[model samples]
Target chain A: MLEWIRFIFTAAFLAAGIFILIASVRGVYKFDYALNRMHAAAMGDTLGIFFVLIGLVFSAPDIWLGAKLVLIIVFLWIASPVGSHLIARLEVNTNPIWEKDVTAARRTIEEGDTHGHL
Target chain B: MSKRNSNWGNTLQGRFLRWMRFGWEPMDVLLIDKMSQDRDESVNDALSAAENLRDLQLSEKYNADTAIEHSIMQELDEWSLSKGRKIVNRLYALLSVTLCVTVILLLLETVIAMPMRGVAVSPTNNEVSQRYIEEGMEETGAVNIVAGMILDYRAFDTLGESTVLFIAACAVLILLRIDRDKDGRPTQELIAAEEDDRSHEPKSDRILQGSAMILTPVVLLFGIYVVLNGHLSPGGGFSGGAIIGAGLILYLNAFGFAKASRFFSYKTFALITLLSLSFYALAKAYSFYCGANGLPSGIPLGTPGSILSSGLILPLNICVGMVVACTMYIFYAMFRKGGI
Candidate 1:
């Protein structure tokens, strides 16, 4: 019964992770700008990876392997956001049209229109 | 632009052609073009003076000679560079494809003739491989069989690999490192490099700095852990050194070269690489000599699975890690800023 429960949890988590990854890829195709794509990829880097790895750990052969997966999760979570932040900075600093897009987004935010652009 | 123009404007290739009109990455595709303005002007002036001199005398022989040379050059360009080059390229591609197909067919034939799987009398299950698998732990005292093979039985080959990395780092250093003269005035290249640096790194970033502060130590520590546990676990010198080098690069990116130079410079890189490489060679020499002479070396291959086991493998792992880490950092520094 416990094995069945664990299997169900693993399947659910894996499905969610796969869905997020697919969404992230779709977002990369849908988004028009680099920052938005970075936002999409960062979602996969954090939450999608978290869910998949956690699902794997749920059915790991050994506790050590599970702990290693957890370590990978921790390390990636710590490392990936920094990389996304750096790439975002590069886009903002390098792209000439970034200023206009950013200011327009800020103006929208001021008018109580919430966008996840920033 | 490519030579072919079969597609009009609808395809991805056409789109690529349209969008690829910008300058090269970093906008410095022609370095000497920008560096020798005075020389170019001087050459132009000298050519014009010679032309004026020729015009004053009106040398028919010189005019005829230049015209003949120009016509020859144009003919050569038309033949080799414009029209005939495409035929040469197609012939070369045909030869390459024939060779590739022959090789693929030969390999496929060999594969078809190979024995079936799950058989007891397989080619791979030899006495030599069996000895390595069974007695490897007892002989090398490494829980990881691959690490034992690489660092013990094949130590000299790994030594050569590390030496190759060191030499490559030296090449990069010679190619990219910007040096100052006795007077310490920056060269034209150094000034240009500084300008490039300014454009890339306009300011010290706070977010990067904070994250680096939190992550550098952890990364470095993990790298050390990996190097130390090479004989016991999966990771070894090359991977661990890469991690350490990555951590160093992150720290460098956050704090800038000013802080990195305080602890690490060209001299430091030289010293560490030199010391590590020489130590590895000398240690390997000692072990090899002992094994050849049928004598036990004084160093003990401690119990397997321990961090301090595997005789000289631990120190050798550390040496390789140092060399790799330094190589990685130096490559980053030289390429990024043309310094250190």
Candidate 2:
């Protein structure tokens, strides 16, 4: 029964890992901007590696090794988001996106009037 | 406007067109023909100037003739102003780097060379050792080996180490602490407010958030375990402190800054840091007093392989760990909040 439980847990972790990887790839292809792409990359790094490392920790032979693995997971958890945020900020500052014909939308929202061109 | 248009049409095609339309009236012909010729000459001069500019831009690698002229002018300017400031600056930087490397190499060589020598230099063989041993046994009543060395034999060194840690904690806190009222205008606040107005909003992933929620607790527990078992194992103050700091960072990431800040407030962190350093200092001072005068020390080093073995190592480790963890978290928070 214990062996079976371990096997099922391992399989679940593996599936999660694969799912995250696939989502990251799809997100990269689907996103149009650097900010969106950064989201995908951050997700891939933190969640994708978390699943894999957690699985390995459970399967490892000793407590010391598992503890070291946990350290790596913790480091990534702290670093990945901050790194992605900085990169996205840099991209936004360097190459900003211009709004297209949003004056009518703004006017309608502000004055409760909708006569201008959309 | 007419002159500008004429200049635009001054290439070979424009001259060809002018030649084709040569059968107009005398006044028209003079105006058109003379203007076209002048335009053509001006266009050719502009093209040559543009080419020269491009050559100057690329002259660094291609070794263009104009590059020599530029270098000559630059050299003359350098000679006028003290003759060798640039060279002196370059040589100064080079010398400093070389000196640093040489010093590091010499220190490493000394350390490596000591072990290679067959001389057995024991700390206990010196004159200080006899006095220390007599005092340690009289005060601490511990006889194993390293414990006696740390607690009674070289208590002064241990005291200095703790004092160093306390100073480090104070320095980090002072450097990282934010006081916008005192400073008048904080640069970080300005940058953050500007960034907040921009198009890009902060992004987060729900899936990662979910996983972090589960992992964070486990990491925290392991960190505490490392700190708790520091005396028994090879791990001690520095490693255990780093582990706990990592756990704090994990919590910070799992929950956003607002939530993490709820548990780890600036006031609470500052108080804890002050209290921990005070505790370490008090412990060391008590040991120092006992060793200086003729007083019996209460702290005992249990059997070597036992869990509660080290005389004061465990308590010292815990104090160091707390100071390190608090300072690290404070630094991280300051950086995250753009206090720098």
Scored by lDDT, the top model is 1
Worst 10 residues of 1 chain B by lDDT: B23-32
List the lowest-lDDT window of 10 residues for candidate 2 chain B: B197-206
| lDDT by residue (tens digit), candidate 1, B90-204 | 9999999999999999999998899877676888776888988999998899999989999998999999999999999999988888888669998888888878887687256
Candidate 2: segments with Cα more than 4 A from true spot: A1-118, B1-159, B172-176, B180-208, B291-295, B300-311, B338-340
Give the candidate number with the greatest TM-score. 1
Query: In candidate 1 chain A, what residue range of length 10 has the lowest lDDT sum?
Result: A109-118
Q: What's the DockQ for every one of the candidates?
A: 0.30, 0.03
Best by DockQ: 1
Model 1's alpha-carbon lDDT is: 0.87
TM-score of 2: 0.50
Docking category of candidate 2: incorrect
TM-score of every model? 0.75, 0.50
Give a tens-digit lDDT track for model 2, residues B1-340.
3455556455655656766787544456558678767787778889899999988878755766678879998888878577577788889999999999999999999887664443446543666766655665434434433445654556567557656765765676676555665658766764664365233323243444656666667766766766656655556556667778877876675465666778787677768767877777788788677635645557675664565765676677677677777767767766555332
